[model samples]
Target chain A: MIKVNQLKKSFNDLEVLKDINFEVKRGEVLSIIGPSGSGKSTLLRCLNFLETPNAGTITIDGLTVDVENVKKQDIQQLRKKSAMVFQNYNLFKNKTALQNVTELLIVTKKMPKAEAEKIGMEYLAQVGLADKANKYPVTLSGGQQQRVSIARALALNPSVILFDEPTSSLDPELVSEVLQVIKQISTKDTTMIIVTHEMDFAREVSDNVIFMADGYIVEEGHPSQLFGNPQQARTKSFIQQLNEKH
Target chain B: MNFDIGYMFSLIPEIMEYIPITLFMAILAMILTIIIGLLLTFMRSSKLKVLNYIATVYISFFRAIPMLVQLFLIYYGLPQLFPVFTKMDAVTAAVIGFGFKQAAFASEIFRAAFLSVDKGQMEACLAGGMTKVQAYQRVIIPQAFRNALPATGNTFISLIKETSLAFTLGVVELFAEAKMQASNTLRFFEAYLAVALVYWAIVVIYSFLQSKLERLLEKPYRT
Candidate 1:
């Protein structure tokens, strides 16, 4: 389970996440949807300590971190509990796809090379890229790279996986291939928090959906409730704008 | 003023004898410059006020002064303050001078190379559960080194040529050997031209190796 209370973050003088609060039970998929620059990504990043929050406590699978005085060990433990998939893929440009997946295993976990390679190959096969294991990231398509990234995150076996606009940087035709890989894993036991702009995918895969606007959570409920009947004016207008575009 | 082709050819064998001295000093200086350059880069990026200030001032000071002046200070001036420096050989003094001066330039190249790598690469490593130090060691440094190769090669080539100034401190290197041979026989043009050919050959060989290494490192990034 993951819980955040009164989370606050600021860049210089400008506040980006303001008194945010939420919870996700184990094995639940929560999707956060909002217009651009609404702090959705920042909120997700704060959970992983990527952007250190100014105040609040975050509990991931029973390890609570108080942001005000978090230690380096606490941050490392937090990262160990969760892995993030970035929009740009960000695979180690120097490593082949299999090496990218196995790097942390061998370096941080001290697993033997053969054991790590076995697990890496399994994850690569899971993402349907087993044949591309030895290929460097530069040789793969953007979609393939993102799939390898997803495979890398899956291999960590973290308590929660954070997807920050994973498809935001892919070509239109390649989006489905990457999304299919995410959907394949969403059915498993791992908890997930996804901040994305793909409304249809969110509505389909998420158990709970959150609508954020200007750094505030305007509404939260089951996807049916949030999408079918938004209560806040900001959420309603934002949904209406998205609908108009479609 | 006659160009003696035979004398120039004959001078090659004698001048080549000092090639090892030239190469030893330049190679030693290059290694020192890399070590100091990397230290300066880390200090500047350390985010501590005192470290950053020291690194900034050090880089600026070393870059502003000429290599010849710096060599004189180390070889001639240092002995005045510390008697121990009087025992130091001219080769050691020359390497120290060249190392300190060239590091300033090499640090900037390293800085730019580190910056050229994507910010997301470090974040990905961290998210994957590696420590900041591990991230830099395993991912960031390898890519940065590759990016730094071309510029670093240029610095090393220039350093080789700059070792000729060590003759001012009385080290018998390639250029120094050439000067002695020219003075003994009064064949200044032939002897100097022969030495220049040797320097040109060394630069060409190093440049070739550098490009080959660059291509090898580029394998992972090629589409």
Candidate 2:
């Protein structure tokens, strides 16, 4: 469903993603665990063209996006196919939760207002915030706001959903509500590429886990294999460090 | 002639006549300033280099020139250059001069408001699948207007006081009317005192409106 080869990116002289190659099958969950500033978030952003890659090609369903040639219609279609949930939530503070979801559907997709609102309410209910649909983002807890953000992405029916440290901003108590939502979402056929620090959640949920450091994917295999008995000294060292962390 | 308190108070009918004309100029100049000021703001923020440069130069030139000089330029300079403008009166010239002059200042207020808007709001709007125009209208511009409302109200209070300068151009507004009354009746002190009272009353009312507007616009964002 997704493919990348020699995917290189850099900010000026500082390379962020160096010679990364990876692929994921349809309906698979791929978790990218990495150190701070390892370009995991940048890779997620590149998938949707929010931040254009500095080099290399990303192909999804035969649509190629890269530095040389990216078609206009393909980018728009790719954006629809890939939805992103940010750490900050990025909800429009001026809009209610209902307005947030229905906004793009009505404005960009040209869905009828009434139809969009109905579907929006359904999604809000799915995320367990049906009563809070009319409330502004300011009125919501960090966890509730993150759920609203998930509903917003779900309403679009994207093929691939990207999560960038989704629960990083929430309280420890609130993180479960958001993680539960993601766990429930995983039961479906939707593909997911999650970048997160929640090790237990990552180990329990991800079908494949890739450990990254210094802009390179140092290890990639089934999570059970990588988490159980790893081969590399660097991978075992980072996992040992992470065991002491939690 | 010991301050003739009773007689000075009796000039009510005379001062009332000038109030409407004064308000008319303030309202007209305010309307003109906001419309053209918004245009200048768009030019200043736009990508076109020449247009942005022109907007910058226009703002600097008007802001640098004194209002009195701007009034004189419109009243005296325009008549000499265009014979067709000879029929235009002092009131028209005052509106033209003050309106353009205030626009330079108002554009800065708008620019600041536009800048304070969160960059993420636009990106999120686009990610939700909104087109560029839809994102700007739905997500960016409304929030910018809310941010701009309080600062723009301050400009309105200053504009009302600036109307006093219109009298210098011989527009016969409140200040000019008071001056004419003082000179004719030899009640210079009483006449100027009435003018002061009138200006104070207008400002007090406008200040109340400014606070009311700020409160109403801020209701949604106040949390």
Candidate 3:
């Protein structure tokens, strides 16, 4: 389980995440949908200490981090519990696909090379890219690269996976393939917090959804309750706007 | 006033004898420069204000002064301040001098290369449970090396040519040998021309090898 209490973050004088509060049960998929500048990405980053929170506490599984005074060990512990999939598919450009998946396993986890390769190959096959294991990221398409990144994240088997708009950077035609992979993983008991603009995908896969605006969680509930009948005026209008666009 | 093409051609083999010395100085100096340059890059990136300040001043001081002046200070003047420097050989003095001066330029090349790597790469490493130091070792430095290759090649080629300056310090390198031959035969034109051709040939060969290396390293990133 993950719980956040009164989390706040700011860049210089501008507040990006203000008094945010939420929680996710183990094995639940929660999707955060918001407009640009709504701090959805910043909120996700703060969970991993990529962007340190100004105040509040983040409790992941049994470890609770006081964001105001986190130590090096706390940040490392927080990262160990979660893996992030970036929108741009940030694979190590110097390594082949299989090496990208196995790098952390070998370097940080101290797993033997042969064991790491075996696990990496299994995850690569899971993402349907086993044949492309020896290929570098540049040699693959954006969709294929994103799949490799997904495989890399899955190999870690973190308590939770954070997707920061994983399909935002891909082409329109390529977006569906990546989404299909995510949907496939959603069927498993993996806990995932996805911050995305793909409203349809979020509605389909998320167990719970949070609608945020201007650095605040405007509303939250089950996907049907939140999407079908948003209680807050802001949530209603945000959903309306997205509905019109698609 | 007469130019003898055959004599200039014949001077090549004799002048070639000193090629090893010139190469030795250049190769050693380049190694030192890269080491010092990497250290400076780390210092500049370090959070301590004092380290950053020292790195800035060091880079500025080396870059602002002429290499010839720096060479003379190391060869002639350093022994006055530290008696141990008196034991340093002419080749050692020349290599150390060149290394310090060229590192200022090489550090900038390394800095630019590190910056060229996408910010996402580091974040990915961190998010994957690697520490900052491990991130640099496994991902950041390797990519930065590829980016630094072409510029480093240029620095090395220039370093080879700059080894000619070591002649002033009584180091009998290729250019110094040519100078001796010129003074002996009183045929300054042929002797100097022979050395110049040799230098040009070395640069051409190194440039070819550099391009080949660039292509080989670029394989992973090739689209």
Candidate 4:
């Protein structure tokens, strides 16, 4: 579980996250949807202590993380519990998909290469890329690369995953396959905070949705109620525009 | 002028003999240069202001002085400057001179390559529980090495040509051998051409290897 209270972040004088508060229950899927620079990615990064929060506390697995209060070593411990899947996949181009997945197991976990590889194969199998595990990122399609990234994260077996625009980089025809993988993930009990533009997918897979704009969480609710009947005028207006375009 | 086929054929066996010496110096110079370049590149990229400044001074100092002068300073000036190194042979001194100078140039190439490796990849590797060194070794270095390869290979080829100047140190390397042969034979044109032919052969071989290496590195990504 993760708890954030009055989290404030700024880049120089420009405030990016202002007095934000949210709590994610264990095994729940929370989707953060917003326009560009709404601080969704920043919030995800902060959860993992990748971004240093300036004026707030984040309790992840009951350990408080902040730039000032947390010890240097504890921040690294927190990062291990939370994995991230980037929109661009971020697979090391030089490494085989399997190496990308097994790197942590061998290096951090100190598992033997053969043992780490067994686990790696299992994760790659989970992502349906087991047969392609020996190939490099450059050899993979966008969807396959993202799956390899997913397998990489699953090998970590973290408490939660933060997906930042996972399918935003994919072709329209390829988006469904990725969403299907995520949709399958949502069926199981795993915590996820997905930053996305796919409202329908959010409605289908998310336990809760928080709509953000101008660095503020304007609305938050179950997807059924939020998408069916948006409470805020801005939320309604934004959905209407998206609906009109579709 | 007319091509002297018989004379050229006669010189072939002698020219072939110096090829290995040329290659040995070039390869040795490159290996030493790459190691030195790697050290300097790491220092330049270090966050500590003093270390970075020291690296800057090193690069500028060596880069500003002509390489030939540096070679002379090493081969000639060192024994005068430091009495103990007087025991050191000319070959070692010249190798040190050429390697260090080439390192100063190649270090910049390495720096660019290291910088170009994705910052995200670095963070990701660290997050995956790799220490900074492990992250660099496993994730960052391989990627950076790839980016640095073409430049490094080019440097090696150029270094082979540059070893011609090692004749200054009295090492009896290829160019020195060529000079001795020319002066003794009284055929500067023919002898020098043979040396040029030897250098050309080396450059051709290196260029071929570079392209092959480029292809091999490109293999995994090739569709």
**How would the docking of model 2 be graded?**
medium
Fnat of each candidate: 0.86, 0.46, 0.86, 0.49
Docking class of 4: medium
Q: Candidate 1, TM-score vs. the true structure? A: 0.97
lDDT of each residue in A180-223, candidate 1, tens digit only: 98898999987999999999999999989999988889899999
Give residue B44's error in model 2 in angstroms. 5.7
TM-score of 4: 0.89
Q: What is the per-residue lDDT of model 3 for residues A118-139, given as tens digits with 9 covering 90 to 100?
A: 9999999999999999999999
> What ranking of all candidate models by DockQ puts the best one first?
1, 3, 2, 4
**CA-based DockQ, model 3:** 0.81
**Which candidate gets the maximum DockQ versus the true structure?**
1
Native contact fraction (fnat) of model 2: 0.46
lDDT of 4 by residue, A1-246 (tens): 888888888999989999889889998999999888889889887776667878788877777776567776777788877788888888888889999898888888788999889999998888888999889888888999999888888788888888988999998888888898888887888889999999899999999999998778999999988888999999998888888989
Better of 1 and 2 by lDDT: 1
As a TM-score, model 3 comes out at 0.95
C-alpha lDDT score of every prediction, in listed order: 0.95, 0.84, 0.95, 0.83
Residue clash pairs of candidate 4: none
Model 3 stretches astray by more than 4 angstroms: B1-10
**Root-mean-square deviation per candidate:** 1.4, 3.3, 1.8, 2.9
The local lDDT score (0 to 100) that residue B78 gets in candidate 2 is 87
Candidate 1 Cα misplacement greater than 4 A, ranges: none
